[model samples]
Every structure is written in C-alpha cells, then in structure tokens.
Target: MAGSAEGFKEFATSCSGRLFRTAWLLTGDWHLAEDLVQETLGKVYRAWTKRSRPDDPVAYARTTLVRTFITHRRRRGSAERPSDALPDLPAGETDVALRVTLIDTLARLDAKDRAVLVLRYWEDRSVDETAAELGLSAGAVRSRSFRALDRLRAVLGTDGLTPTTQNEVS
Candidate 1:
C-alpha cells in the first residue's frame, strides 16, 4: 500500500502538467481545465489503489481525461450560455491575443469536432490511437479529422488556420 501510494504520487507529480495541458485544450478555460485534471487524477488514483494500474499509465490517463471531458459535455445542462466577450485575463499570459483567438475559435466548435482536433493535431496522436481513444474506426477518425479541420477553417475564415496537409495544423 505504501509503495502503491508513493508510485501514484510520483506518477501524478510528473504527469499533472501534461494532463493539465490536454485538459486545457479539451476545455478552453483555465479553471475548468484544473477541475478536469483533478477529476482525471482522482480516477487514476482509484485505479492505482486497486493495484490494477494500466501497463501504460500515461496512455490510460490521457484516455481517461478525454473520456471524462466528453462525458461531462454530454451530461452538462444547457442552462449555461457562453459569453461572447472573454473575461479580462490576469497578467503574465504569453501570446494573449493568439491564445485567446485560438481558444475562442475552438470554443465555437462542436464537442466531438473539438475533441478530434485536439487529439489528432494538438496531441499529435496517430489515427489509430485517436480512433481507439474516441471509440471510432480508423476510417471514421480520418473522416472526422478532415471534416473538423474544414469546420475550423470555415469558422476561422479560411485564412487564419490553413494547414498544408490534413495532418498539419497551423
């Protein structure tokens, strides 16, 4: 038990930042990203305590975070309306305008489209891996990736984010 806790602590300490980054992309808000990471780690910790931790904990965590994000999106009530105007950001955020623009554009995307884009482009995940994570066939992942990028291009006015290739993200 002691060893298990220590191992879990070590894994969490090392992976939390990466997890947070993925969560941040999945959710376009810092606070929400933090909450998502917390929830993901909670799930990982439960698995760890069971001594049934995955052989690849990193992959497991990533899958868990993605699944949790989509699940929450599905379950969340539509009572909360998104505001067009972004809140005033705190100091010291690099590339504020760029980040805000990208996040804002991403926020406009459908949940599944956003997930596909984040996994395929942001995470640099392969088609098969993304397919497994999102529970789609490889062909489906490819189709969705293409459509999602097109949707993103449409939303960004076709001039803002035109990647050279389907896999490339600008």
Candidate 2:
C-alpha cells in the first residue's frame, strides 16, 4: 500500500535517469526514449504488487526498457525516416561531437545489433547476462558483440568521425 508506493517512488527517482539513458541508446530519439522509460516504469509498478520487487530494480528496469524498445520497433510506425538536419543536442550536454557520432552510428545499426552493443558495451554487461536479457544464447551474444564493434570501427574510420577515446556513453 503506502509502503509499496513509497518504495516505488524512490526506485523510480533513483533509476529513471539510468533507464532513460539506455532507452535513448535503444531509440536514438529523445522523445521516444522518454516514452519508453515511462512505459518501463509503468510496467515495473504494475508488477510490484504481484511479486516481490527485484533485488536490483535498476537492472529490472533496464531489461524492461530494452524489451519495450524491441517491441516498439516491431510496430508499424517504428521505422524511422532519415532527416537532413541534426536535431539540436540538449543544452549543457558534454562531448557533443562524440555523442552525435555515436548516436548517428547507432541509428544506422539494426535494432538487435544495436541492442547487443548497448547492453554489452555501454552497460558493461557480461555476455551471459546480456544473453539472458535478450533471450539469446551466449554464443549469439558474443558473435553479435564482435560484429557490432567491427561495424562501428568500419563506419568511424570511413567517415573520419573517430573519437580520440572511446568512452562507454550512456
């Protein structure tokens, strides 16, 4: 009741930013990322009463956000059309050029490839853990991880958009 509500509030407050970062990487669009985070939080809240809350609600929320992004991408309107002009980066965002390059590269990737990369590298998740989250075999995760990185390297090199240091961006 009240206790459950309070716990959820705290969890959401602490985890929402992390979840939104994952969502943004998944979506490549801020508005869609916000929607995905809200949807994930709603799902977590709905399940809170039926089962004990996850030991790591942040992990739980991330899984939900990834799955929700996957589902959304399957829908009819989810295919994005390329735009000529880049959207303005959020104010005070650091590493503007690097972030823009990463987001652009990520957007070019297939949804599953992007998901595998984000989970494995961006989140620094283990192969087995990412496999479990995406319901793939560990071998599959490994293969995808290799291919995704190779693609990024190829693209960055050809475009001359390589960052000095590759940081695991949110």
Candidate 2 residue-wise lDDT at 28? 81
Error of 2 at 120 (Å): 58
Query: Whole-model Cα lDDT per candidate?
Result: 0.80, 0.82
lDDT of 2 by residue, 1-170 (tens): 22288888998898899898888887789999999999999998877755666766777878888899999999998887778999997555467676788789999998999999889877889999999999999999999988887888787675443333455255
Which residue pairs does candidate 2 place in steric collision?
none
Q: Which ten residues in a row have the lowest lDDT in candidate 2?
A: 159-168
Candidate 1 lDDT, 56-130, residue by residue in tens: 889999999999888878875723757899988855434446556767888888887788888888888999998
Model 2: what TM-score? 0.45
Clashing pairs in 1: none
Supply every candidate's count of residue pairs whose N, Cα or C atoms clash at under 3 angstroms.
Answer: 0, 0
